[model samples]
Target chain A: MKALLVAGEKSYLNEISYLLKDDQFRKSTKNMLLCYHSINKIIAKIPFRIYETFDCNEIGLFIGTSHGELETTKDFLKSIGIDKRARPFLFQHGLHNATLGFICQTLNHTGPAITVSNRFFSGEDAIDLAMDWLQLNKIKIAITVGYDSLPLGLENQVRGLYPQSTQLSTGSAAALVLANEEGVRKILNTNYSINLNNLFLERITYCRTSNARTGGSTSTHYYDSNAIEEIYNNLSRYPNHCSTMNLQKPNGTYSVINMAS
Target chain B: MIASTTPAVAVTGYGVVTPHGLGIDPLWSNLLKRQTCIANDTGTGIIDQDILEQLKYSLPKDDGESASCGREKSLLMALYAIQQSMLHAGWTSLNSDDGLIFATTTGYIASWENELLGFLSGSRREDSFQEAFRREPLGTMLADICNGLNFCGHNLLITTACSSSAQAIAIASDWIRLGKVKRCLVGGCETLSMLTSQGFDCFKLLTRELARPFDKKRSGINLAEGAAFICLENESTIVDRQRIQARILGGGIASDAYHMTAPHPEGLGIYNAMKIALNDASIDKSEIDFIHAHGTGSYHNDLSEGLAIQRLFGEHSPPVYSTKPIHGHTLAACGVIESIICIKTLTEQILPTNIGLKDRDEKLKINLPLEHESVALKKPIKFILKSSLGFGGSNAAIVLGGIS
Candidate 1:
């Protein structure tokens, strides 16, 4: 039932400009293009032998985003307001699941694909769902991505809403390739015998602070969407150890990810 | 029916707020009467303003200091549906460990449009614009629902366009089966907005006339808006047999990996999803009494789904019907809303007909109930299948069984 983190990649702000020049991503919207490149990077990093074991039919794709296609949505809305007509392409690409479709089509992957949103905790939520699918033996491998592109003229608005938020002002995407023990063993080839415990997600927990006056709590915290990349960095740096990373926003809403070798 | 080894998942309670009216009573009655709720001029199904105002007043007032205040219409609809569902479940409050999975395609889009339009025109005040921007993110809807209901367990907001809510139900059922939670609240909410209607119109997917599913001259979909929630629990957790409404036999999800707006020409993805769902339910195709199709009345959607149905069930395909002609297509909310209708179908031993069909499309070659055909089963209805397809090639199906 263990989900091993086999490969990962990330892109932040200007680092994603290279995708804009690629012909393969020319028709892709910003968020879709960003995710496409990130997933490709993860695929490229996988060993040839392991990559050969991937079953396109059994691979699960999970995407998490705080504001999906906001930029395209704005453009579509503008078209409606000024021209009194909206573009069909913009309307199609403006959907939140458009990125999921784009990735699956480009990769020729037919699997269980879903897009989830939990604000700042979207990354963890995506990873958690991926892990559950793996644990349930539903798929051989899971590609989980967390992505968000801030809409134009909305950065200041976000900052005003969450003054202490550090990562909500920019656009970024992070991806992880996870597999169960049996799938990982088969992918690595039994002869290679790579340690399955090098790095794997052990657990995930989401917590929110309760309000005493209202008897209910609101999620006002905004945390980094690329926290998964940070977890990847920590696990790689300190091998053969257990690590617990606590990600907390100023408002006391936080999530914890347990990684172990 | 095939035997299942996995833990049984039960549907204990359900509620809805559709254009037909609030709750299942009005929707069922309207469907039986073959009523079309879409407005002729607007080509959309709109909920009454008085019902909305009454729902708003029934909800607890938000304290000014809370960030969850100033909610959008979609979130308000979701809260009202949740209220109805909880009350139907005979629970005054939710356990801290209960989970929630929400689905929506356009989250606060109307509010965002208003704010952005004002900001661009330079005629609106900045303070008012800022207030609108605060409610922009789709996740806020999930948070607001949690705060309103005091639900603090596992929760997620799914936005896979039209398939969003069906996938939410699937995931909630998975959670219950895996012992992640004893019970979960699964729901979808969508409110009419200029972006959706005009956007679909741009694609030429909106009907100029009435929606007619499986009809030779059927134009396209009639965009609509609503919210629905169904409470799913582990069958072992339910102590009262009278509380059980139906059993969630199984669910499956898959992507077409085809065009962004168009489904696979042959309906390969839809067929695979239905097959997987039947397998998950551990049942043979013959066990299903009928199917609630994602028949949007759009040419491509109806043809593709019909082909999928033909491919799966072959010559013995069960009677298929789409309620869009009655309630219009509610986009993301159709999955759960139609699911509630399926529950009613199983419990009542009645089958709804495809309302606006004047002439069946011969190319489909699938069994479709005729307009004005009212089918009341002499024996108990056993199982039903509900399927949904989204704009991004997302497809999902769920199997529900009547209580034995």
Candidate 2:
């Protein structure tokens, strides 16, 4: 299928806009989502990864999934009274690779669509791998979906790994459609970057019991503590070198309240 | 070698552990004989009766908890696989400078899942979770395996869904080529957990019998659990005595960006992944002699995978076989272990038959290997494409060719 990257989840956009309404972003919208999210975050959870990597308005081909997505397609389609017979259409797009399928289906185009995950780097890896799909010319359009949600299981698993930190934050990711076009998301013009170094980020632990005991009244999001962006920023700059960055969190769940697009 | 940055991965060795087959030989034999391990559950010793009763819908109440096995079997299988692979590659030892990329969708999840259910039921306390919640986790357990085996290296966990192990292979290959690690033990491991079986049961997708992929009468998948690892090296990295099983030439991953639980109705993602692999290896589709399809055997899965095959190779998809019929679905271990089979098949030219294709789907027009067939390539082939699709929309295709 043509590498058609069209749209991505809107949750992160909502979060980004919510963040944009904040004071820090009002003065300099220069980087917009970049300021809020990392190149990885913006590209990964949103349409940023494939935004500039592919020709958006051409041959339709998309690839992505909303990991435990907040806005589930099943419920949405079902609410609208979508045909059970047409449900495969719903299932097709709902597949973790559905982001790509929808791009193809909506673009009124028929092409290959693939969805894969290495858990966290799915968006990044998908973009890199998708770029390699083209033979004769740039794929018509490649939509890359890099969205994430808090599966209760993943939260507990990651929490067990990093227990000093508690609470789960669900994220909605998006990115624009792309093809053999151009964009400025990349430092070097490429769809995605592969970081294979065994960089061990230090335990930038924030310990507080009150935070765990309290609920929404003291909710904290990944964006609030800026841990997510901090992670990418530190990792990207240092490559394989580990860095420990600390930030405090008030009591509450790491809400997906305000973040990058 | 000025840091070959391209994605040319090599598999020096591989290991496996499963109920049907304890290691490669046993697993292989089971695959050949179609000996399924799915049956009435016996005590796996991981759960208790109360929780079992709570999860009533799931059959084999005494059966395999295949879904979460990534967390369960990964450690043991990883150590086993890493040990064998290292021995095969002749790297009897390693120091701290090496690296690791262990992949799994759910690492230590079976433990965590069960304990969490206990926690919710108030039977377990937070303090009891100390071991399960450790930082190293199952992934770190792999690092420990490296250290125990005297392979010193960096350890990183790659957690993609079903494509996890394949991604581990791809990523490790890239690292070796980049001169990051002289060698890396890359693989995915997982184990059966109560939660997984229950979850599948909740979805009403669990098959009580051994899974039958591509079979017309196949009901659903029979989840199994296990681990597999490979010692991957570069041309000049290090030498070991273990047989050089396979060299990873090319592989690609595609995103359907579609639904969370189904492949594209048209099998588009599968096609893209296939095209990427062929282009990556610069091999023609016509050259493929065998295809180890990610045929989970669920009606939907087979149908989607079949359509994908048609879309990519068009009518003549290579002689195809799905090992799930034999070993059941090994989740994270599926790719690595299956790749080992592909590598073995390529080396010996012995393609094991699909053990469980009882009733064939008329719509599935591809040639299904129902019996062991001599590898009938024009010559000792250079490439075999393996495909995998995950629970959510995840698909990975990797190509392995002759080591020579």
Candidates, DockQ: 0.56, 0.11
Index of the highest-DockQ prediction: 1
Candidate 2 versus truth, CA RMSD in Å, comes to: 11.2
List iRMS (one decimal) for every candidate: 2.4, 9.8
Docking outcome class, model 1: medium
- What stretches of model 1 exceed 4 Å from their correct place? A49-52, A164-169, A190-197, A210-224, B1-5, B60-71, B375-379
Local lDDT at A171 for model 1: 69
- Residue lDDT tens for model 2, B291-327: 8898886787788888888777777778788877666
Error of 1 at A147 (Å): 0.9
Name the TM-score of candidate 2. Answer: 0.65
Give the alpha carbon lDDT tens digit for every residue of B1-404 in model 1: 12255679999899899877778898899888877788888778888887777667866675232324456677778887888888888777789778889999978777778777777678777788888887777887787788777667888888999999999998998888777887899999999887898889898898857899989999999988899999988888688988889989888888898999999887877888888889888889998889999999999999999999999998668888998989989888999999999999878878888888879899888778788666667567798999999978999999999998
Q: Pick the candidate with the highest lDDT.
A: 1
For model 1 chain A, give the 10-residue run with minimal summed lDDT: A212-221
Q: What TM-score would every model get versus the actual structure? A: 0.94, 0.65
